[model samples]
Target: MILVTGATGHLGAATIHFLLKKMPASQVAALVRDADKAAALTERGVTIRVGHYDDTASLDRAMQGVEKVLLIAGTDEENRVQQHKNVVDAAKKAGVPFIAYTSRTLKDRSTMANLLMEGHFQTEDYIIASGLTYALFRNVLYMDVIPQFVGASVFETGIHLPAGEGKVPFALRDEMGEAMANVLAADSSGSAIYNFTGSEGYSFADVAAVLTDLSGKRVKYTPAEPSVFETQLAGRGVPDVIVQRVIRFLTDIKNGQEDDVYPDLENLLGRKPASLREGLKGLYNLG
Candidate 1:
């Protein structure tokens, strides 16, 4: 059976949605912290196993008889390194033959030190050291988040942020999940690192152009100072922690850190992922 962690999350749920298209629900299991939240999945015949990254015994129990496990990246940012290690160790102890992890794309870890990238880097090392046949899905920024980044009043306020002209190869999160499900259902063990990104990259200027064409509004891209952007978000009542996190990524974008493109996602889906303009149309409700 194949087990998917973080089963209630968007990407994990979508992965199961697509996986069911290829195999029966009897061959599927879900690792969730609370079974109550997985009632919908349970109704669909998916076996729900209570587990947490902090609890090793729970992880071991959840991995029982599981041939492949998708270790969805945990959200406990402060404690995630050790938490991910716990899951990998438990999977190793349980003798699970194959493991797939959802990770992020980091262009350079040597020169630029980022807390987010550091956590993923450490987790990748432990997974490799565990000696299990593994597939690391290094995902990029999601097009789903573009709405959040630009805000609902983007047509009035324009695209205002500190991201500059740096481009991001943003893929749809659901599409990324679809690719993961395809790999998990493969005939052979998935044992390679894959970069899950869009076929092309786009800058904020490109985003503005897309919005203009789709919504009939002349949107503009404005590069602001990080401090100024922080003040603006603060004034808008965005939480401090959330604001800082957004700025961290915006700073990375301004530095051109996440500008690379890859073919792994398209290769897995056997089709071209949605383009930026097309994705924005759906995201902004223009269609």
Candidate 2:
């Protein structure tokens, strides 16, 4: 059976959604901390296994009789490395022959340094040293976050961020999940690295143009001072923690830290993922 961790989250849920298209739900399992949160998945015939990254016993229980595992990265940044190690360790102890991890995009850390990705790097290193066959998916920023980055009233308020001219290969989360499921279901013993990204890269200026075309409303792109942007988010009552995280991404973009473009996403999907114009239509609720 294939056990997908973090199964209730969007990415994990999407993976399960696509995996069920390829295989019976009897062969699928979900590792979740709360089974109640996974009622929908359970109702769909997916076996729900209660587990968390921090609890090795629970992880061991979740890994029982599982042949393969998709270890979705945890959100607890401060302790993620150790938590990831625990998952790997449990998978190893359970005699699971193969494992896959959801890692993030890596570039020379000139901006944000390793603050945002240290956990993933460390986890990758640990997984490689383990005896399991692995696939490390170095995923880029999700296109789903574009609406949040530009704000909800973007057509009226325009696009304001500290991203400057830096571009991101923002692939859709659902598409990435689909590609990952294809990988998991196709192979059981090989090892590989996949840099999941969109078909093309786009800067905020490009984003503004796409919005204009999709909505037929003139939207402007403005590079704001980082401090000013922080103040604006705060004034709008964004919590301090979330505000800081948002600023980190904007700063990373402003410094050209997330501008890498790659073809792995398209090659894996066997088709061009959605373009900026197409993705925005769905995001903006434009029929």
Candidate 3:
């Protein structure tokens, strides 16, 4: 059986949906912290196992008889490193055959978004050190995060970001989920690391143009220094660490650190992932 942690989350739910197309419900399990939140999945013939990164025994119990496990990275920013370590240790004890982890793109040298990437890198290191057959899905930024570019708050006035005019490859969460499903279902031959990203790269200015076209409103891109951006976010009640990390990511993008587009996702899924324009069309109505 294949077990998916964080099954109630966006990416996890998408992964489970895609996996259902390839495997039977009986062969799938969802490891969640709250079984109540998983009622919909439970009705669909998925086995729900209560577990959390903080609970090693719960994780071990959930992993019982599980052949493949998808360790969806925990969202807790402060305790994420320890949380991932716990999950990895439990997976080791469970003797699961294949362990698939969702990590960040360019983690080995990511100066941008180190707050987010550091946890992913640490988890990747732990997985490699575990000596288990593993597959790492290094995912890029999600198109969903683009929503932050709008609104009356920060970007409502102007597109304020530290990423100058550089383009960065971004992918939708569903695309990453589909690719992850493929990795989880495939045979564990030689372990592999796949960098999952969209087929095209777009800069903040390009995104601003898309938003303007979609909303029929003029939007301007304003690039700021990383320090200024961090101060602005902090003054607006954004946590200092999160603000710092986001600014760093934008700085990296401005420096052309995350500008490459890779076809690893399409090669894995045998199809092209959704494009930015296509993904943004639906959100236009919401905005």
List ranges where model 3 is wrong by over 4 Å: 107-116, 149-156
lDDT (Cα, 0-100) at 172 in candidate 3 = 84
Q: Candidate 1: where is the Cα deviation over 4 Å?
A: none
Error of 1 at 232 (Å): 1.4
**1-287, model 1: which lDDT tens digit per residue?**
99999999999999999999999999999999999999999999999999899988899899999999999999989999999988888888899988889988868776442457678888889999889999999999899999889988999989989988989998999999999999999875447999999999899999999999998989999888889999999998999998888898887877777789999999999999999987988887896
- Best by the lDDT measure: 1
Ranking by TM-score: 1, 2, 3
**What is the Cα-based lDDT of residue 184 in candidate 2?**
90
Q: Point out the higher-scoring one by TM-score: 2 or 3.
A: 2
Residue-level error in angstroms, candidate 3, position 106: 2.2
Give the winner by lDDT: 2 or 3: 2
Model 2 TM: 0.95
Candidate 3 residue lDDT tens string, 1-287: 99999999999999999999888899899999999999989998999999899988898899899988898888888898898888778878988767889987763463544556677788888999899899998888788778764445423676878788878677889879988888787777868889898898898888878777777777787877777877878888999767776776776677776677888998987988777777787655534
What's the TM-score of each model vs. the native? 0.96, 0.95, 0.92
What does candidate 2's lDDT look like per residue over 1-287, in tens digits? 99999999999999999999999999999999999999999999999999799999999999999999999999999899999999999999999989999998867544463376767888998999997999999999889999878878998989989888888888899999999999999955588999998878899999999889888899999998879998998998989888888887787777766778889889889999988877878978775
For candidate 2, give the lDDT of residue 86: 96
